[model samples]
Target chain A: MNEPILRIRNIESFYGPIMAIRGVSLDVHPGQIVSILGANGAGKTTLMKTVSGVMDPEKGRITFDGQQIQGSEPHKVVQKGIVHVPEGREVFPLLTVDENLSLGAYTLSDKGQIDHDRDLVFSYFPVLKERRGQEAGTLSGGQQQMLAIGRGLMANPRIMLLDEPSLGLSPLLVQEIFGILKRLNDEQKMTMMLVEQNANAALELAHHGYVMEIGRIVMDGAADVLLQSEDIQNFYLGVQEEGARENRRWKRKKTWR
Target chain B: MDNAQLLISGLANGCVYGLIALGFVLIYKATEAVNFAQGDFMMLGAFVTIGLTNTEYMGLPFWLALPISLMIMGALGYLIDRLIIRRLFGESQTAVVILTIALGFVIRFAAGLIWGHEPQTLQNPLAGKEIRFGGLVLGMEDVAVIVVTILLTWGLYVFFSKTKLGLAMQGASQNQLAAYYMGIPVKRVQGFIWALAGVVAGIAGILFAAKGSVDPTTGLLGIKAFAAAVIGGFGSLPGALAGGLIVGVIEPFASRYVAAGYSQIAPYALLLAVLIFRPHGLFSQVRVKKV
Candidate 1:
């Protein structure tokens, strides 16, 4: 598929002696939204951290655009056009919204380009425009998520890695943000690697989807196929059989089940 | 005019203390460490200037000697971070605080060895000069101190708010990991902050020396500056200056009017009062982040 823009092979990352991501491999092609669906402890965050060089993999090869970037420093990785919009919306609370976006473009040298990128981000999340001068801490949870994504867009990244953009937001807000992600993918042809627990929304917009279970990938397929699969419907999408309530403990499992 | 005279002198003293306190706030905000060695940097700054301006030492002109001393102090600060503080990464902030306190000792000892235990003053063009207008009389040195301190404080406020590096530094101070994600070199920015604090200490040292005499023990003045930082609300730059001024203005009045032996406790007394009443000092920053 036109040589996937990011290639991760046998990436084994750890938290000290505890292996969090165990020899998992995946690919994300250019101009495509690839969603990695997993439960809370599925190592999705760790995988994103490894690719963005926040946490170095204990053993693996991560090549972006055919250059090794597995163990590079986070800033160096950013210069190579990999932006990680980390979980929990870690915006600089004391800084103004404009200031936060400006810092996201810290790797870029051209001032004009920075201004243009800022304008582009403002267009995507016009609410951020309304609160450009407000301190980021004052933003609502939904707006903070938008600011986080807008900050990533300020980088003009070749590929953006988003860890749980739908996290800690209302379902309505989640739908709105996912709709924007869909728009960005269609309009700007933005390449995004989205890690999410909201399987239904993520798969609905993603070009391809992979289901991860406890640090390993159990299913990978076209988004539509994965959406219709009985395993995905039962486990991820929570689409139980007719008149069957998903109330039991230890009821659903992964592909193996 | 007697009180006016007292006020002018107090303001000048407060300016110096505030300048030093600014150094404290700069370092604390970036690294979350109380740099007890900050006053030592000031002492070394004055010693360096004295070494340069006095004919018996470097014999350099004041103009040449000033920038040179600042650069030297800046390098010392950067080196301290690169060589010492960076290694303390992943360690507790308390460890950094203790390390800085120990460094203060080293600095005091080193100054004693290099310049001798006797106090020395810088030979400058401004000392012993005065300005008089109407009922108020002010020392030219004091006037210079007040004017320069205002300028420096304003400059720092602008730098933090207007410049790109300054904003990045602020972002890094607030969230180091997110700053890294934004492509900011957080560690190097921290090193630069130390360098900036060093330069500030040097300028304060030179001005303090011009105002009076300096010895190995001069750095202990940083203690009062620390009090000023706390009084300034810890996070606010203007607050630091106001805190310094508050401490400075009270000292003379306390010694002149209060009971004997209590004059020495005046600044600390004011600090205690402020802490008890304001709690967040007279000026808190950014309004608790709107949570």
Candidate 2:
């Protein structure tokens, strides 16, 4: 759709001998938030890692802006404008917040432009500006997540692959982070591919959603349709009164017997 | 030699050790792997200077020859990084260590073949001049060594703390993957560091040879430098210099008061004690990794 900005065709990834993702295919268009919803160990992180060039796919092609980039180095991938904010917020602990932000713009040649971006990032996450002199490790989970996002922004990426930005955060922080993500998508028109276990939040934010189970896509549709589907209601939301009533009847019959 | 004269000689030797140890610390910080060939690089630099000064091909003055040798050695370091060390990037720590050791042997043998086995003296402008302070006598050559070491150390402190490139190098040293993501050309920074380390080692070699003789066997001095690095804290820059000083001061004292052979063993013993007590060294900052 609309000349997919990133196209993943039949990607299979392995960790040594064990296959992590099998025949996984996905597409992301410009200026859209596409979410892959799955439980833990369902290849969500693996897919993100593969797309980011941290992990090499054994089979299939990854075409970014119509150019093959299946086995490129991670830094080269960043240069081509696909910045991955990896899971668990892997910020350099010892480096100051400002240093971390500066590192994010490592690829940009213009110092003036980088400084502008730095100011822009601080505006987006004002708390980072207040704590710019502090070591990154000293930041709380929510702040670290914000710093990670700000760092990604410094890269000036065309597309951002965010792997569970809300992980290990308080509910309040999660809401705030999601709000920022929405703002980034609407105001900046930033394209994002988000992998998250927060199914409800993910469905609410994503334009389109793919439901993954056991390393394969089980359901793919508009987020609203997926949210309203009987299958999803039964499996994820546990809204099956009919099944519960039948289970009680069966229990009664067994007791009588 | 009297106690005061021994102290002067010891401090002079310590300054040389400190300089070489500085190189070890710099390269190790940038690459996270000890370049075992560091000593051989110093040997090469000294011989390069000797060649330029002695041969009619260059006929350059000692001052000109020194910088030229440093440049040549720096180029050699850059080449080594491009041709060899870069290939070993992201390899296991053990593999990198072994690779550098192999590189050291190659450098040593190469220097031996090129410069021949004979020991040669580098002519110094103040070879015989000594300044006596009360009971203590200090040679002009020793003074040069102390001054140069102090200046270089100060320069390096400013470089790491105040400069952008230095900060980038420090960032790379601490977390290379993160540094790469930030847009630092990690490879280029590493190459620059290796070249810089070579220049430091070269300066140490010239200073050392100014006081004594230079030969292929001089590369073995790296072992003492390595000892200094271990004593300092493998990762600490200041620690390397202090470690060098300790080794320098202790060796002469041990030889005089203890036994002649004991001086050689003193550094190793100090290294062992440090490892057992403070594994990070006296000055190195502790780094904790998240699981």
- What is the per-residue lDDT of model 2 for residues A1-257, given as tens digits with 9 covering 90 to 100? 59999999999999889888888888898998999987788889989888878789999999999999997777788899999887878787777999888778877778898988899888789999999999887888889899989999999899999989989888888889999999999988999999988777887888888877667887788888988976666555556646445334322232210
**TM-score (all chains, Cα) for each model:** 0.96, 0.87
Backbone collision count in every prediction?
Answer: 1, 3
Per-residue alpha-carbon lDDT of model 1 for A160-244, expressed as tens digits?
A: 9999998889999999999999999999999999999989999998999998888888889999999999778988887767765
TM-score (0 to 1) of chain B for each candidate: 0.96, 0.94
* Fnat scores for every prediction: 0.76, 0.31
Q: Give me the candidate number with maximum TM-score.
A: 1
Docking class of 1: medium
Error of 1 at B173 (Å): 0.4
lDDT of 1 by residue, B1-291 (tens): 788888899899989899899899889889888899999999999999999888889899989998999999999999999999999999999999999999999999999999999988889988788788997877888999899898888898899999889999899989888998988988999999999999999999999999999999999999999999999899777888888898888888887788656656988988899899999888868544322
Candidate that scores best on DockQ: 1
Q: For candidate 1, give the DockQ.
A: 0.65
lDDT for A107 (candidate 1): 93
**Which tens-of-lDDT digit does each residue in B1-291 have in candidate 2?**
497788878888998888888888998888878887788787878888877886533567888888889998888888888898899877887888888788778877887888788898777577889887787678899888888889998998898766778878888887776676655678899999988898898888898888888898798899998898888988888999998888999999998899999999998998899999988887786755442
